[model samples]
Target: MRDIIEIKRIGGNDVFTIGKIDIEIYKCVAEDIVTDEVIITDERIQHIKSRHPDDYEKYCKYMSEIVKNPEYIIEANKPRTALLLKSFEDEGIPFKTILRLVTSSDNITYKNSIITFMKINDKEWNRLIKNKKILYKSE
Candidate 1:
């Protein structure tokens, strides 16, 4: 079996494939807010605080910067995206086909993460879905 792995976003809709798995991408959009000292209320921040309290302050500070200005995150995520694309190319998979399918789909509002789904050809699908009986005889 051949599998394709990569991430893509079309019309703000995010999609990705990993091996034979397919999924939809959902991004957590940070809301712009104003406060006296910038509260780090994101779940990620809390989680980091619990596990890495030593770095929690710095992590929260960084998260605040990301929330206040998202361009940094966008730039940071680009290189990771590029590496993922390279991985797919190395795997001999057609990443463009998946993007085309998502673009042609009716869904939008997904972005910035990788979701993967198993997409089998019609012949394979039929073979898998068809009812069959295995006969075994022991002598």
Candidate 2:
């Protein structure tokens, strides 16, 4: 299965509401980077649930796993990392797997910090970075 990874830049940074696509400030905190700020918001959960009410119960069962082990989400003293932890938890991903990916990636904590939270290794990260497209898809 392919891992889904997407980044969106909210041009209307000031707007905070469920506009075209529902979105909530899922995570907002400080980061140790030149930007010094990171925000992780989820728009698909609600949209997905609304689109599939029959599976609401099933999805709830999966979402419950996120609360099962909070410690599984590691904290590397970075807001971006923490946000990624939450993302992993939402997807029902294991912390050990995330850690393993970290080791596989070269100094993930410093180089390509976001990759530490991603499923891709350092090589894939570099490849994706090189051919990345600037897509500002509107909801």
Candidate 3:
């Protein structure tokens, strides 16, 4: 039996919580962390054609200009994962909950995002967790 059930929708993410465990489900948008630009895919192109046929050409021209630079619109899913992590931080949730998120297979945050927020999230205190002294080891 589940004691607590909570579902939260943020942006395009659906975060589910049963008891104390949280799981996030979301489609990652292609966003370039370097140039802070987003890549426009064919799906969006079709959407533009359907919604505003007259502007489709202009949109394509602009997208073409953006893609000229290789780093302008590279693909990355870290932003979606970062958003979920930030929500946990803002809510004053314990690291245990946040840890569950990264450990879960659903959303994987590379060492980059998690390590970046380490100090802010007090990651040094990971030793306080039960399994840390046994299972936790920094590589």
Who wins the TM-score comparison? 3
lDDT of 1 by residue, 1-139 (tens): 1122344554464333322212211022122211112121233334544654544442222322222222111111222121011112233321101111122122443222221112224454334324322111112
TM-score of each: 0.20, 0.20, 0.22
Which regions of candidate 3 deviate over 4 angstroms?
A: 1-37, 64-139
> Ranking by lDDT, best first?
2, 3, 1
C-alpha lDDT score of every prediction, in listed order: 0.24, 0.28, 0.27
- Candidate with best lDDT: 2
Residue 110's lDDT within candidate 1 is 25
Candidate 1 lDDT score at position 49: 48
Q: Each prediction's Cα RMSD?
A: 19.9, 15.6, 19.7
Q: What shift in Å separates residue 110 of candidate 2 from its native position after superposition?
A: 32
- If candidate 3 were superposed on the true structure by all CA atoms, what would the RMSD be? 19.7
